[model samples]
Target: MRYFEFILILEIGILLLLSLFGKKLLNRRIVSAFVLVTLVAHYFLEGIRWQMYPTYLMAFFILLFYNHDFLRKRKWYIKTILIFCLLLLAVSGAVAKLVPVFDLPDTTSRYAVGTSNFTLEDSKRSNRKLNMKFWFPTSKIGSPDGVYSENPVQTLDGLFDMPGFVFGHLNRVETETYNNAEILNDSIKFPLVVYSHGAASSHLDNTGLLREIAGEGYVVLALDHDFSFSDYNLKKSDAMTLEYVAQKAFITDLIDKVVPNQVQDIEFILGNLPNSNYNLVDHINFEKIALMGHSLGGTTATDASFNVQGIQAIVNMDGPLNTASIEQLELPFLYMSSFSPDISDKSLEEKGLPDAMLYRRVKQWELENVYRLHDRNTIGFHWVRFRNAGHMDFTDVPFMLPIMKTDSYDEHKGHLLKSSVILDFIDIHLKNGKNYQKVKDQSLEWIK
Candidate 1:
């Protein structure tokens, strides 16, 4: 929580305690004044959050009920209602304070991060509209603010039966990239990294990691399949690859059915990105392309490396590789999975499933990638799991929506590990990182 918010919650909590148990120390006039003052500060300075309405109402209730004489005159039901309201307030207030909006730590790279968006309709006969969300290194260090795109609560609302405003507050979570900041004019080019989101997720899911890597002079392009912005989340999985395979499909069906569509998404980006006239294109090194994705996006990245030419490496962030994509794709792949125990508990408590399905999916993806890495059939591959993180932990959703984030997973620790390791891998393959061995770990066991 931010400092002002912490103090506000703390003071309000103290006032509540004094009102309930410190009758001997209570001064009605002073208590009334204190409640009024706190409410004023909350609305004007601290910013009123939706979940804390109960807490705010509690202050108003205290003002109405603090006087014993006035309370004695109130109808029995009114007093009972006030009591019930306090209980409700206490519960919501606790949740509000507990699940505070978290700030992303500053990027460790030297370059400033900037983001820009462009729209294109592929002309490849099967042409489709695509939204390209790109984060690239800029000449300046912190030019301006950039939009983070999708809000987790708003994005997830249709998937669940919850009220919309319950997560409206998540929209307040922000990113540091200056929108379309001027690209650096250096003659040398930067490596390309294509990122894809999980099923029913947004390209904006991994902002912290994206910004960190982009700041280090990589051109990160995340493709937003229009389905992600539509009501498809309620109808199907975000990653089309996971939907059709459905336990009954043959590998032929998958190759002809789903993988082609994902590959099409990548091809369109690669097709338009170089000539789209965006300033960042000046720094694109097509020969150094690397693919990264979460969930089904990983499937797309894996497929692209196999089907498309010039993709140097791959990073699959906890995504399952469909039979079709894994069969033909064997590139330098990085398998980053979150096998944390906290993930299982949250999944069970929230979705009523054990999350064992995730483990199964991880094993499936790892086995394929490990085979390529160990056999030297591929360039290189690494499989590392975050023991304290869940599938959601791979992205920035947990950090923005703390309720979705668990206490056990240190978001920073997991992010740092992934960032340093992936950056090193990208550098070793796409740029220049002869020190890749320095990032070796005993804890992050590699299959090869």
Candidate 2:
């Protein structure tokens, strides 16, 4: 158990002790003060910033129940309410600890396929570098270990600390440790997938999902945008350097402006294969390329499909549309969101793009194939709402944070649901003939 878990258990014990000794503890201001202090400490240690409201309420009730003189004066109904509150606190604490938070499958293999860099002459002058890895299936029936970005620990530390801020405590894992060589040559010609990460996030964020796809006989290519969500190694001068700040600012500014230009970059990376350093030239079925991205990366994927020729399908995992490219889209596309379409509207508008625009644009694409999944209609565009999925549901980090209990984000469910849906769609349009009936019949939801 981690330090957090130990602390949680300790808190539960305290609550139990208070509940059992309420009569004796009544009128003891010092004990009440101790409880209050512990509660405050709990909040800080657990990082429960938003969850403090309910925690405070529970603590208040614990204090009220322990004051027996006041409880005796109250009516039976009031006493029952106090008992119920105590029960609620007990249940909440148990639920917090007992619930299996993030769902991640055991990873089986990892592979470092290739690496390359691109020079962005359009906006900020810099080299866009990428160290792409491919995780493949090694066995027919076995759970695989989860994959991470070339630098797992660093990525997590960066993600947890703040966007764009790199902390010294962050740890980075060896890329080879997450790379699987045995499965590199598993298939003669596998399906192709191009992945783009979120803003300030590296392509390594979705290693679990990427590896799962590769294991299913697909060559997944993940690229890092120059000056966007990537870390650059530079020599330092006396610890504090204007050059470092300038470099960081330059990258941040690049990501802000590059959203629109990413379409071209995607094409530049895909069309010019040799430039990408991927050696699956003989293994890739160029005609069956699929584009995918998360958050801001999702917008890139959507826009790139319009610019990148020969792409059969696209998947946008929670990325709102970029107004510039939405109207020009001309391929089969899938939009998977954690929240309902309603919540995504503001993000769409902020980007000067909205789902209404996407809907119309998709309609214009008229590829003779389109599908939607919502929270209401299971058979139509709306599928069942994944009860507890958060915005980070589409990525792999939620699965790796074992102590952070997230009941709604199930790795197996997410992996099976997302992979099965994407694979089925790609298989039908890119590899097999159109099978709208399968998607409509909800057959894609079932996964082995």
Q: Pick the candidate with the highest TM-score.
A: 1
What digit string (tens of lDDT, one per residue) describes model 2 on residues 418-441?
666666666666666566433332
Where is model 2 more than 4 Å wrong at Cα?
A: 2-103, 107-125, 137-150, 153-157, 160-187, 226-256, 275-277, 341-388, 401-411, 433-448
Candidate 1, residues 333-428, lDDT tens digits: the string is 788766533344455344322444644453454456445444654546577766556678788866666666744667777778779888888988
Stretches of model 1 off by over 4 angstroms after superposition: 3-46, 59-69, 72-79, 97-99, 123-128, 141-167, 228-259, 340-377, 403-408
Top candidate, metric lDDT: 1
lDDT of each: 0.66, 0.52
- The TM-score of predicted model 2 comes to 0.53
lDDT of 2: 0.52
Residue 175 Cα positional deviation in candidate 1, in Å, after optimal superposition: 3.4
